[model samples]
Target: NNFIPFYFFVDVYHEGLQYYVIRSIGGNLILLLPVGLLFPLLFKKLNNVKRILLTGFFISLFIELAQLSISVYIRSVYRSFDVDDLILNTLGTVIGYWLFFILSMFYKRVTYRFKSNTSINIE
Candidate 1:
């Protein structure tokens, strides 16, 4: 159980373990990117940034706690809980939310232009 944020990062860097840093940090960040992108699209209530942040945080926290519980139950270190994972995962979610926001805005603008340019008259 590692509660210190970015603590593993410092140790890995000192040891010159670039691969570990990339795999750990990058993997965690990418792991939740889909959650951020899909949650807002699937649930209209999660369209705002604040809602996305909270959802991401709670989800990451649950995963960490679950890992801790599983490790304790198995009497082995199945996975260590790290605060940095929560931070990176939440950041990934926010990044995904922004990407979704930009895509939605672009879609709206394009569709509006298309609608405005063509008209059907009926009598």
Candidate 2:
């Protein structure tokens, strides 16, 4: 095989999809703050964009700070501190905002249909 010896793919010790998905989803949910903050700014008729964007920035900052404490206090033997993870996590929230935009188009269509159907007079 011509594959680079130093570039080996991940070798897993954990088995079963439950562990797989839980880890994946937990990280995603942790990173969802920016979009969560943005939703109200875009559609809730509340929360100005500046406040939401500031909140997202500070939250990501705080998470990076907490990773050290979390490693020490939450799991002493399980994790290492990494700034790259913080960057990736914040980036994931941004990507999720785009996903939210895509989903809302479907939501808008469905809600319009439902509202139109329900507003008809029975007479």
Q: Each candidate's root-mean-square deviation in Å?
A: 1.4, 8.0
Task: Give the distance in Å from residue 121's predicted Cα in candidate 1 to where it truly belongs.
Answer: 5.6
Tens digits of per-residue lDDT, candidate 2, 27-75, equal: 7456754564466547664244454444455666676567667777876
Instruction: Score candidate 1 by TM-score against the native.
Output: 0.94
Write down the lDDT of every candidate, Cα atoms only.
0.91, 0.54
Clashing pairs in 1: none
Tell me model 1's lDDT, rounded to 2 decimals: 0.91
Q: Write the per-residue lDDT of candidate 1 for residues 74-119, one digit (tens) a residue.
A: 9999998999999999998988898899989999999999998887
User: Runs in model 2 with CA error above 4 Å?
Assistant: 1-30, 33-54, 69-80, 121-123
Model 1 misplaced regions, further than 4 Å? 121-123
Which clashing pairs does model 2 show? none
